[model samples]
Target: MAKIFSSSLGGSLFKDERFLYQEFVPERLPFRDEEISELVFCLKPASEGKRPTNVFVFGKPGTGKTVSLKFVLSELEEFSDRAKCLYINCFEYSSKQSIISKITNFLGYAVPSRGISYAELFSKFVAVLRTKKVLPVIVFDEAEQLLKSEETKSLLYDLARLPEQQKLSIGLAFISNDNFFLSQIDDRIRSSLQCSSIPFESYSPSELKEILRERAKYAFNEFALDEDVVPLCAAHAAKLGGDARIAIDVLLKAGRLASREGAKKVLVKHVRASFTQEKPVKVEVTSNLSEQERSILDLLKKKKSQDSGAIYDTLKDKFAERTLRAALAELEEKKLIVSEKEIKGRGFTRIVKLAGS
Candidate 1:
């Protein structure tokens, strides 16, 4: 409490700070009325116990697609009890098992994290939906993240075929920033979804100003922010694809910088400085690293390149083959290490090394 009041920046600069968060969906969105209405209509059928038409929403990063869809779903849940909304981020849950497990878990079923076959897991998924007698709407955020594997195609095929297979009421909404997303997926998967599509236009400079001012009124003290701060943030963000998130993030970062400097108000200088502060990497954090992964990286850091069998031998006492393989896969995914499979006479030898080590 003491620290909260001791700074010259005041107790806080924000009224409802959550409005600036990526996941926060304001009750009323600025400049997105049309998009919101379209989304609401897209999900309206779910309330009547019918499988609503699937929707594919695409736009560049920081557009309002994700938030608007979420806002619609939130409102739908408020008045309807026959439908449920589920959101999944493909970048985080990329694997088939991970995706299936998340869906089943969201449906109130529990199964082992591994060793659960896709057939069995999906069987459980359909059974739950059938028994619940409720419409299930799934929003796949960054659907393009799943396009790298055939399993994703399989997943989409199964979901699109679910109604015919089980006669269950289910809906899928795919969101992607890449304009070419449709052309890249399997033709069959694309044909099956046949989604109602909507594209979010980029925000203009004037539009960004309105968004920034609106958020500022609720995000900061009336006089604690300089008159030029919002426009500066808006202009900077507008130049980079008119991302409202960038504008909001800049404003939030400026406030923190002002507080850190013991300044009474956030100013243009803080906004400029905030732009240089690199956002933290979200893909891999040291704490998320498994013991074996950390050990493997450490070993490679000292021992340099080593064949997979030799590396496995070095840590066989502490880790099992499955754990080692899984750790290697994660490390490779993180780009902390690189593995190359070399064809031998009858098989292949896997070589591992620290990337650029």
Candidate 2:
């Protein structure tokens, strides 16, 4: 094993930091102070015993919608002894039954195995809340998925009406990356919700740089990271829609890669390699490429042309039991090969060529 060393010069920058870099998101959200204040006002004591507000929050991914909601709920919980706050990520618990089960579990109630509809479970949930004299505050994360499901939509409808039936103070918060959620909602349900909507926009380059700087202090030792890294990472993420998560991911990966190479500080090469490695790929297509397509493409240079089926059959001997047809289709989809179909003796055969060719 190779010995690792920290750069003497970089070691002095981030000493004795206790706060988490990515975690401990500030109570006052960065660049979202106004939205935080508005949410806080809606959850204030005057609104406690009254019917709680239905809130719809929309933003692109990494805009702090979930974190801001959690922050507001934490504050509400601290002040109100009579209210209950529950957070659910609808993407994970998408169905009504699963979401209700989670709610029951959160309340410390035994989740029944069967024989309970969403309505029944909700009624039971309200009964439990009434017995405890606690108002319910529900936050649904990834709520766009819920809006797409009829069962979830019905569940939301019932939740909105809970206050009318049981006099329970119910606040429903829906967090979504998709702005189309509002338009997809049924007219009657939409009318009943009367949800106050809030939109979270992507962070600007300066904002992303500030966030990355804050994260670096907690995630790395003082002076472990290069000064240029934060700005570069921010610029890269800005090109891809200003995703904070991607910026953090890039920073973290670059640090790890540097550490692996026994380097004292992360370099631009490390960041570039990390960014390239994280490119998304279709798993099935990548895993099952036809040997012919792979071989022919490997041999050809950019703008090179080749016969499709003939090349495919030549490679077939090397990969017995592999389907050439499927490989050609996959290659075409990937734009690695371009095929032209022409009539042969019995049927049409595609004349394949390299994409650039």
Which RMSD does model 2 reach against the true structure? 11.0
The TM-score obtained by model 2 is: 0.71
Q: On residues 1-357, what C-alpha lDDT tens digit does candidate 2 reach at each position?
A: 543543422333334333334445564456878888777766664235555667888876777888898888888888877667888988788899888778776777887969887778887777776765566678998887787667888887777666676666667888887676777788877877788888898888999998888767766787788888889999887765566876887887777677667677877888898876664443444466655666666755543655555665666677542456555555754545555558888987767675534
- Model 2 stretches with alpha carbons more than 4 Å out: 1-28, 280-357
Off by over 4 Å in 1: 1-12, 279-357
Angstrom error at residue 218, model 1: 1.4
lDDT values for all models = 0.80, 0.72
Q: What would the TM-scores of all predictions be?
A: 0.75, 0.71
The number of the candidate with the highest TM-score is: 1
**RMSD to true structure for each model, in Å:** 10.8, 11.0
lDDT of 1 by residue, 223-300 (tens): 879999989988877766577888889898888888788677888999988977733442336568989999998899
